[model samples]
Target: MLMLRRTKNFLNAHGVEYEKEHVNPLMVPERVYVLKFGKRDGEFLNRFIVEHSYTWTGRDKINKITLRLHGQKHPREFANEAKLLQYLEKHADRYVKKQGNKKAGKNS
Candidate 1:
């Protein structure tokens, strides 16, 4: 919950309003987070749904997956956006960080 607060605060400080919505159990998500940043292809701002999972299993074995974005049309991995959780905890850096990069930042 602390990480979520900081995330929302960080975005809110940047003049961006972090959005929170009640997730549906049908989506099979335990939680959800979202934010809107500046505009795009049609002069409209793009809002991204930030989805993350800690662990999952298939065939009774651990599965590896990280944060992803579900575009209105399809789901895709936006590697860069992982940095949005830079200041976030919850052992997120392990999956979010790229190889040999000290941390998730613009330079990273």
Candidate 2:
């Protein structure tokens, strides 16, 4: 109770709530969603085991298909181009940061 009282007294004395509330200026996108897919295990090289089962696809379709057909046969490893830059460049203006008065979460 003493700590809470002290904090309240300090806030009241400082009057920070009225001291020019800083508006977080940002371009709030209309839609927000998570982009999840299989990431390469190698840090130096974004490599993944790709076989005939794992084919390149748009919008992470390949990853989904690989998940479905995984471990059925021997897979051949190859470099996957699922990097953030390539994805963003491919689909421009699709996602944007949602700035609001909310607590940060995972990947936020």
Give all TM-scores, in the order shown. Answer: 0.34, 0.16
Give the CA lDDT, 0 to 100, for residue 11 in model 1: 53
Question: Candidate 2: which pairs clash?
Answer: none
**Which digits, one per residue and each the tens of the lDDT, describe model 1 over residues 1-108?**
332455555555544433454333555644444554443443324444545444455222212213333234553344433454552344333323244545567975
lDDT of 2 by residue, 22-102 (tens): 122256311111112222342111112222121245122222111111233643321332442344345333322233556
What is the lDDT, from 0 to 100, of the residue 63 in candidate 2?
27
The all-Cα superposition gives candidate 2 an RMSD in Å to the true structure of 23.6
- The reply for model 2, stretches above 4 Å from the true place, is 1-84, 98-108
List lDDT for all candidates, in order: 0.41, 0.27
lDDT of 1 at 12: 55
Clashing pairs in 1: none
lDDT score of model 2?
0.27
